[model samples]
Target chain A: MQDTVLIVGAGPAGLSAAAQVAGVGYKAVLVEKEDVLGGAPILSGYARLVPSGEWARDAIGRMVKRVEDDGNVTIHKGARVTQLNGEAGRFTAKLSNGKSVKAGAVVLATGFTHFDSVNKPEWGFGTFPDVVTTTQVEQMVTAGKIACPSDGRTPERVAILLCVGSRDRQIGREWCSKVCCTVSANLAMEIKELSPKTQVFIYYMDIRTFGLYEDRFYWKSQEEFRTKFVKARIAEVTAAPDGRLLLKGEDTLVKRPIVIPFDLVVHAVGMDPNMDNPEIAKVFGVGLEKHGFIERGEHYTNTCGTTRPGIYSCGAAYGPETIDDSISQGMAAGARAIADLHGLTRKAS
Target chain B: MAIHEKSLIEPERLLRHDNLVVDGVDVSGHWNTMITPRTITDYDDDFEAVIQRYPGAENVHRCWQCGSCTNSCTMYAQNVQFNPRYWIYAVRTGLKDEIIKDKDIIWQCVSCNKCTSICPKDVRPEGVMKALAHWLEDEGHMPKSPSRIFDEEFTEQIYARGRIEDSLVLLNFLKKTGQPLVPQWLRVFGVRLMQYLPVGLGMRFARNFFIPPRTRSWGRTGEVLRQYVREQKEATHG
Candidate 1:
């Protein structure tokens, strides 16, 4: 049996997992669906990493270089796993490119899909030109300008609506998209820095910047950047006759209903289960939780181990997670795979 | 059904038996409290459009009912029934009966613009409140509210002359609204004012009240504005 680990997806989790596997002298096959590596944050154009304020490309590029330089790691970009067969220590993954890799264990690091803001028609995501998702705003940040999509003028006032597709029963997403609060806070600071004249208002049900990120991003967003946090979930977005977007929601803290016009509206969308989650779970012979994320054996002890013995899952494949958690989980999954493969090798000998 | 606001549910719909025995069990007071099942078939559909035709309420149809307007409303703090969000919802949903129930208090909006400033949807709920008040008056749902009478009295002076004499407007508004000209508070305030007033300042105030100051070249400007207002009122009401 080949002492190799097959890593599905080439996101932060998959790349870190592959790096861990290769570091342990085991061959690691990293299969990515996209033509390029990095994943959503890279493809969608994130300007900078949150809290650190480091350029996204540079931070992610360092990881990409580590994986590429390792001779034990093999990267197959623009490829997807078409088929999975066999059990632990004899797993084979057939690639879309007609290539197959037999490995001792597999790690599914497939990440999440950005929640589609269009699903919530009240946000006026697609209907209004100035109303855009957080991902789209990230692209604008990368473009080095925050301008109204309709008029191409610099937005004098921008409203960032947090938890757009998360924590709302109406959309069937009750779980909080963990990273959005920090991301929105970071983005608010970024936008403020980009255009100091522009007023940034964040309408949020809660500011959930858990851990040190709270002090680094959320606190800084308020204390340093002067970002206005309105404690309310926006009810609707409508375009004004003058091309500005109007937001309706209550300031729950002040207990007042408010309507304010903004030059641009940014919907801080959350993460949904990966679109290929069902298909991936089916092929891998794994189980999915109620939310469609791959079910882990036990979070505390067997954090990376999936319902299927040899098949493991990490990062957003399990649930909504931050990049740091994904990377750490990737390492944990890699360590588990290596240990499993070592046991098999010892038995064979 | 998805947008079931508890505030929108009328007290009449709430059924509660103070003392009751049901099927060998006592279901009294809170235990017996139930909401009557209701099927609303009286949607005016065109109510939102009609309200939108008012001067400030052009964007009434855009209410997503986040409850921000009601939450931030100045009038809402004093009276929970003065809910801009619920009224906006009623207008958008064409619940004419629901809106009519709150007609008396709808004109008490204070023009604080607090709702307009904080609304994320830019529904301009303050304007919607004004439009609703106007609609209630235009439709003859009730007599002109005291606030509307005060507005007309204040506005008519401006439309006729270049500006308004504060005393004239105040007295006229009081007369039109059928309030005592010399209220207890106003009498006390006037007495306090006289105690602090200098002879020159008091004489100037008296002269302004008697003569009523007018802006120069006001005749043509006033005529044009009067005609414009007349046309606008006709266009909106007709």
Candidate 2:
């Protein structure tokens, strides 16, 4: 039998895993829930990367095309793995489309969900006409239009609420949506470029400009885009009669109750594991972390494969992660799966 | 794939700055900033009492001021000095006055819950924040702020209506906070319209709100919570 690797969730992680497996002369079966797959980054559209600053559509399009044309790769659209069984070097996955595939290894690259802003009703996500999530803003940006969702008119003052559902303990979401700080900063700059007339205000606690992009992006956004970074948590978002949004927050540095009015409000919503992960974990006989992310062993041993041997997982399926990190992990998982298959073959001898 | 090379600090390095007294180490005039001669108070008694009250608050001591908690905090993205990690460190070591000095920020948390989720150890950061809030109030360092007033109003409103009444809560919150109404009549009217809907419709509008809703033993829930609190206290104390 030909050794095959099954990659689930065709986001950056899954695609990367498929590409890596193909490079190593192994067949990679890539499955995705949506017809198109770039995960949240693709969905949010503003992949306006610095350096070249290509929109997500173009960047992801090139990546997907590369993986699709690979002879060793099989792309399955509108397909989700409903079941995962067996151990490392030999496993089987049952898909929602009723196709059962036996594989030597499985890689789970399931990504994250946008934390529901409605939970923090004070931020006025569902209630306020102007309040929207980062995902919605991505759609607007992708359309080459930057207008208030509440009213189609161009917004003069815009407030972006950071850490909506992430980093909150009230509703039991305690993990930092790792990407929010960077994404918010990037989006704030993008919005400014899109609408020079719009004054952008970021209501934040501490601006995390970590890694290579940390303070570099922060300083650039501040000096270039003039994004007003505030040190205060917004208490609530209330709407006025004219449909403008009211943001109530404490300007902690100044120790004053600052009430700012804005024409548009974008919630820098954090990431959470997709809801179906728990069921998926049970089916695969794999353990998940408290946050419902796949549990990995030691950083090296648990690079991609789960505690259950023959079952490897990667990407956001573990938790909130970035596109680049997911791709790296996907490659790691592919290498691990191939090694396991090699080990299985050696053991038979 | 071009992998970004990240330097992983050793796990022990995570606790580098934790629990060390600055003996004769004057941070004064370093980095062009004058370090004030400060008296760091050891409110060990108060800290013990706080740990006694909220027994689970011991995790506050486990913090190493690594900025990880603050970095992970939703509020940290908003307020830099409202650093939960630093505040928890101050609280753990009985730096009561320093903690009280930052009391205004105690209410800034929306409890989006990212910090606790990302905490490598199960440190309940929100719980620690609440404990600090309680301690600040108990110590009488600051007067009743909007959040406290809001809490009182919420309790009274919920007690009276058997559920939270949004219109009343807002009105009472505003009335107590002494903030001028931006559009007083319109807000009231709009809320009234919201409330005028049938109970079913109202519940759908504000799921937690109820006017004539059925009441199930608030007394029982309170007692259960109290008992749970007591058990936690005893466990921690033991």
Candidate 3:
């Protein structure tokens, strides 16, 4: 009877874990804090995903449907495991929806929160209506119109500044977000395709379209779509008297300061540790790393194993990760949880 | 692709003390040349538009300052100062003062077209170099160069006669540019060619030099072509 896996957060990681556990004929208890599934893809309304160019709703919707249709998976929407009791083999969890479930393993798939652009006031995110984040640009792309939010006019020139919230020593964020470069490149191509007349410029310190993404996003954007990449880190974004946004920065290649005017400016914001990492650590009786992510049990052998036994975690709960990577990690964590539980049952016999 | 410019410390900015002794040690001559630091505060905003007004420079605004053009440049390999990417950046950003500073070196582009072939943005940097040199001469920033005179002679031969007389074109180009009529290499090549000469081909070349070969059907085509070129120049410049 103690073969159930309690999975929290209905994101890509949690959904993948739920499907993996239920597919093997084991009971899975999936509890989500949100009313609907699919996590940030559906919540943030991402237009098209990086690397695949698939619509977020369509790609993540399939994962959500797979877990929901599984008979062995009992999902509690808008609920959380308020209290988790007992040890690895015999664990009892109390949900926020006034239901208690008995499980052998627990998986925390809590994802990240997008870095708010308002924190960098000089970038003029909140001060100007045309200064927006990459997420807002995605929303604008999904709406099929790229216009200035203030005047609702087609922009002649748009500038995307990379590493806004990530890799900024002033903000105390030392880690790279790992996806903004590719995301901004993909977004540049989409913008050029949608509005061919509009010139898009990406200001970057270093273009880290690492590995396979180099040719896919960076090269394709410049070669095919005519997107401009400038080696510059924009220092400030202010408005001109004519209502155009002026970007101040040195053209690092040419070695001179420039103040260029643009109709719109975008901040390629990064991902931060999930805000509930502190509370989730206390409730689950697990330790957190220095950056406030869930710490692993041991550096030698732990891939998904958390500080506490039988309490595994995956995806952005540990650090900033892509959806594809998080999904794979979820499957790995689920397999580890079930394997460890089966070993405990064998020992008891 | 990184250019370490010696022009950063200009000759005019250097103060040379020929016979100075500092602290009982003679730190004179080469060691005494001290460079005065300078700062720039302004740029000519319309300089990019002025360059684009010239032919082959219309796409200067499309440059993103990637160093690919400079990396693949033939002239850049010979002399690092002849960087198409840096000059294009200066043109786009309306840095006229900086461009004038490189006037002595800007015309050194050999027109190998390697930079154009490899440019991801299709900027056609080879054409841009030609246009920029013409702009420098036209704007009175620099005197007319020999390459511009050579281009004029070459184009003039094409318009006057339908076919090119290579020797005549070379003769006219050297005469107008005030260079020596026969350089050492050409003199050596001419002597070698005369020694191993085929009589029939040599006679044809000599005859062509006297009365250059003309395309038989070129009736009013040359006049019409000249008229069209004049109209284009007027339309663009005016």
Candidate 4:
């Protein structure tokens, strides 16, 4: 039997890793917990990808197609690796779907979970009908009409709040969820495009659009789209008697308090570690960081390699990362896994 | 390190020796303006705790100096010296003298509640402003401001009658503040109101001034509220 590589998760990272593994003459078995491929952005129906205003389906579809077309790749949908056993060059992953696979190396691409806004009661996520998450807003954007969920009327004013669950010491999450700033900026531009008359306000403590994304997404949203950037973290979101949402915050730049009314409010929620991280780590006999991400060998050089030899991890499973970076890390993990398997083959010979 | 608020320093305290040289350097220009430094030994360490005893200032400890309160303050827009964030900082640090410097204007807060609404830490800075203003009067740093006199007159009427006679409260407030019974603006407004007033309503309004209205069956309600207020004051202060 040809040597096989086992990959968990069918997200951007997993799909890229599977494509690389299969292209390199090894049979790849990809397991996905979800019934369909393409992770959160595709599943939730993302309107457009950041930095490039392309449809998410088209971009993620290309990666999904590459992995599916490769004859060396076998994809098992709605399946999960319940237990993993053995070390490098000889590992077994027992799947939930009454199946098992023996592989030369394993890659854990299990991604992140979007932060639930319910944790922040002050944002009025569940209490108010007009309040929605960025993912829900993505679905609304995909629907091609921006309206209040409460009244189904076109929203004249919309407020987008950034850093919902990230970099908040009160919530015990001090690490910045790097992609929220860019994602919120992109969503703001999308709202402005869909409803030209609708006023869009982004309330943020800081706008960190690292690298080229700053110019393409954040700055463009402000300069080109005329989106108002308020340097303030909103304290509360209360419902007005008129069924409109009230956003309370102080504009730090102006040094004044502002209580504005909006027809709809979108929370740019941050990424949280997957709930199953500890269980998955224990099953795979791998180490996890304090934040519960699958710890890598060395951050700089061996980013994809896990503490256990021949085991690898990439994408949001390692930490919060953009789709583009996740795919790049996926390929890196595939290359390292191939090299590890080849060294084992040479040793056997 | 001490926070030196330049505006707080008096112009008289700043000494500029135009013709003096030290260490063979001519430092006699604008650069030579020297501030007379004085050591502050009196700090009311219990100042913040005392302010917290008042209603609305319970969350003053949560302020992270994010400046949200001052940034959103209504008074700060009119006067740059009216900084709620800086005052809170002084209160938190027990810098009694620093806070007392702005005693005259602290009571000018309009209580618009914009600061309370926007405070990310739930500091309820509007309430803190009220608490601070009240503390200023209680500590004998300043006398009762016109706004405080108005609030007390209005609130006392409410507690006594379970409701308020607007004209009585306004007249009592004016009397307590030693202002004219009818100011220039009120005279103009009263003249304009008389044109729109119906004869019967105007007669009733005139009667209200002579005989102040009181709530019917306001038996022990007034006594109970007064007792509660007294008890609360004792509990908070002592």
Candidate 5:
């Protein structure tokens, strides 16, 4: 009998894993909680197909079609694996809306959730109409316009707050949330392109432009777009009478308080593990860290696999990751799961 | 096939059930290092102790080795092991010996207050790290480096003169720490020249260097601190 692999989530990681499993002949059943496949990336509307921004619609369309047409693969939309039982080689899953399935192995590509901007109320996410999140900006860009949420007018000036919840010890998230700097830089460029008249300002503690992501977008914004890169953490956001927002932050480099008024404020919120992963861990009989990511085994041998046998996880399920890293991790996890299933077959034989 | 075997093969029942036992226990002494008590001395002088203290650092006992603080640290991106989280965990569990091992790092903090700012449970990871450095220094575990000489000389100067004279402190630190005085000479000359700069050019910096650190208005902050130190010593050894 052909072994079956159940993949939870339909984001980049999930779709990538499903493609690998189907290629190797194990029946791949991909489940998604959302009505569509792409998850938050689709919601945010960023076309994060690697090698510097290709059309995500085309990429996702191809992957979705391939998974749908594959003889050994099944796609379940608006369905979630509510419960998981048993272990490697023979596992059972309970799906939402009262369906059940059995699988030889499980892959949890349940990705991360964006840290809520409202957690630090000082930034005035919901309190002020102009202060929006990176996700909101992505949606506006996807809709072919960059209009301020409050007035629906082209904002004359925009301020992007980097590390809103990320790298903030007060908010209890200290990690860099790696992708924020790149995403913020990219978004700043996107905003400048979308609305050329609007001056963009990125308020940051420090510009962490690491890897190939270094200096390219940052310099482009500063030199070409004339984006103001402020070395300061925003202290408070207060509303002005004329609907403009006032931002107060200490320019630590200069050691003075900088009060800037902006028409729009975009909070470059950080990423944290998916909200549901903790309950999922309980369902799967696996361990989760205190921060609530599925515990991985020795990172070398089991980079994408969990501490439990036969259960694998990849991408933002561990922490924040870019779309490229997520896809790569999905491929690695798929290969591992395939090897595991084949190993089981040999043992039985 | 038998019904029982069929039930075993059923996908829903086979995977979602967990029957493992996980009873919680105080697993503090599980580490081999905790098996024996390690004896060490506490803070050497009252002057050093005052600088080490931060209000509301007693919650250092609540760290659960979560590694969240370290992983979340912005500083961790630069260096993974320079973790306030682990240091806090060590301090919380009374793992003084382990914390003292990190004496060199305790002083390297940039004091951006980022760790304390982001703590989830208000663990004040930055404050705890400061407390750890203080505890280690109290225990005579401070690294005998240039920073130490700076601290010693800075303290000695304040005691000698009512207020700090930067020239004297720097000279003393260089003399004691064996740092070449040539660098000090260059810095002193540079500072003298800097003092003549235009308004708001180097005024703030010059003011900081020349003016001593402000103390309480009662003129008894130093005296009170000294008395407290003497009492602590008596209570410990009496």
Candidate 6:
């Protein structure tokens, strides 16, 4: 049998990649940093996904199951690739678990980290319990309830603030975190559905519910759910006298600087580079782009190629990506790795 | 539907029906004010190119809509409606009607040059403001603003004599725009200046105002420069 294909991170991208590699009559080894499989969807505890509306646990769980059920695939939970050395066709990866794997090609699916709300302290994320992130809100939704953590009281009004920790020149994060607009729109509708009495207001610099998401999330939230969309990025989130969150912002549409109160404030945090990117890049011998995501090579020519040959990267490792896109890219990266592996095996023989 | 740009939802565009009837059910208060849908058919596709024809507006096409110009504008600080960034967007996207809506205030730009200095794309927003103001006047959308008249007379003085006589600039400006020769503020300032001025300085001011000092040997240069300026104006306005 040919050598195994090493897949890193074991997220949506990594899992699908591993499954694809194994399906092609080659061995697949998955090295995950966390103890369990399923990347952000399982790790971050994501709720209903966009477009499909399937629970992340069920959707991404199926991907995990497929990879796990494949006997040709080997999974090392709670482990990392501490070292990687060699050329495109032949490479050796040393895992943190005191094991080594000789592989034909490496697939780095190391995904992104949730932009910590603490970086933008002005939004009152850490200081105030009511001011939570989009991920935290997703977790709350998964738990079948949306209540303020402080008193477990159902909020009368909620404010979903977009572009937090993103598109802010002050903090040096100028790139738009593509998903926040659609995610917040979806979250607004979910919040409205969970609590019929609750009034939801989405504050945004601009709405970028791209492509097919326009009718599904942004417009549907406005039409059916009655989610109030305001074209104003909240400048500050301060605690009111009675413990409600006060949002200070310029309502640019109405052309007035306004201060409004809300029960729960959701900061639609952006996607940052994976925290271990520097170390991963060093180990894998790949380059990162200006925005800190893995650098892609001759985009159209190389489907998922990294700086170094024989290594492919996909999903948030490239940039802010949706779960569906990450999966599709996973299959693509896997197909690429399989093609590379086939060439390497031919050379070895 | 909740548009971020304020101008898109002007009062005239928004229609509120006090008693709206769909099919005899009186669904008035149930539905909110509906924005009168406008399908803009008269898009001047070459609007950005037209704006670039004006002096200092060459970089209008390079705007990435970062809003640094509007954010740093001195006029914008005073009044948010005076948005250089928004006007640039309108010009780039060929929204001439949008630019026309704020005709009166477009000339209020004090030419502070703050927008030009802060513009990352080197859009030269101060120049675009002047260009828009001039475009408005050229298109007969607005009357020649007082500032335009002052700029013309002041520049004409320099072209005519190789130097501007401040009194002549002021006198000619007031005459062209139909204002009194000596306004109240100018009169008050004049009174104070004459009362407090040293004897020799006041005499020099009088001589300069009456004779209007011309450059030595400017005989041919002044005429050539004036002809060049006229040609430039014709080339640009066309």
Candidate 6: where are CA atoms >4 Å away? A347-349, B1-238
**Cα displacement (Å) at residue A29, model 4:** 0.4
Whose lDDT is higher: candidate 1's or candidate 5's? Answer: 1
Candidate 2 lDDT over A1-349, as tens digits, reads 2389998888778888889999999999998988886766675565565324577778777778978899988888898888776766667788889998888888888777778888888788898778888888877777877887655899887788888888888988888877777777787888888898787777887666568666556656654665666667988888666677777767664354656668899999888887778877877787888887888856665567577777788788888877778888889988988888888888988
Superposed by TM-score, candidate 5 places the C-alpha of residue B34 at a distance from the truth, in angstroms, of 61
Q: Give DockQ per model, in order.
A: 0.01, 0.01, 0.08, 0.01, 0.01, 0.01
Error of 3 at A50 (Å): 1.2
Question: What are the interface RMSDs of all the models?
Answer: 14.8, 15.5, 5.3, 17.5, 21.4, 15.1
lDDT tens per residue, model 2, B1-238: 2112213432322222323335656433222222232333112324633653674465554443445667888887877867887676555445565576678897687777777787765667877777777767767766786788999999987778789988878887887788765668878988999888577865565755544454675657877888999999999998
- Measured as a fraction from 0 to 1, the native contacts recovered by model 5 come to 0.00
For candidate 1, the per-residue lDDT at B158 reads 87
Candidate 3, residues A1-349, lDDT tens digits: the string is 4689999989999999999898887888899989999988788889999878999889999999998899999999998778889999888988889999999999999888899998999999999999999999899888888999999999988899999889887887777888899999999998988899887888998888888998899888866775767788887898899899989888787776778889999999998888888888888888998777788777457668999998999988888788888999899888888888888989999
Report the number of backbone clashes for model 6.
Answer: 0
Question: Model 6 residue A296 lDDT?
Answer: 93
Q: Sort the predicted structures by lDDT, highest score first.
A: 3, 6, 1, 4, 2, 5
Compared to the true structure, candidate 5 yields what TM-score? 0.59
Across B103-221, the per-residue lDDT of candidate 6 in tens digits comes to 98989999989888888657799999999988999999987768878989888888889899988887888889878977889999999999887999879999999899988988899
**Candidate 1 lDDT, A184-275, residue by residue in tens:** 98998889888988878778877789999977887677656756666677778876776677787775643555667788999898999998
lDDT of 1 at A146: 88
lDDT of 5 by residue, A1-349 (tens): 2288889888888888999999987889898988887766775676443335666676766777778889988888898887887778888888995888889889889998899988999999999888999888877766778888877999988889999878777877877888877778877887888888887778887777677776576655554555656567888999877778888877554344666778899999888778888788888877887667778867887767787989898888888788888888888888888889899999999
Model 6's DockQ score: 0.01
Q: Among these predicted structures, which one has the highest DockQ?
A: 3
For each candidate, C-alpha RMSD in Å? Answer: 23.5, 33.6, 19.2, 28.2, 29.5, 22.8
The DockQ-based CAPRI class assigned to model 3 is incorrect
Model 2 in CAPRI terms: which quality? incorrect
Model 2, A297: alpha-carbon shift in Å?
A: 1.9
The digit string of per-residue lDDT tens for model 4 on B1-238 reads 3335556777657776768788998877555777775433222435667888999888776565678888888899999999998887677646677678788788899999999899876889999988988788888888776887898988898899999998999888878888898688989999999888799987899999999998999989999999999999999999
Between 2 and 3, whose DockQ is larger?
A: 3
Report the number of the highest-TM-score candidate: 3
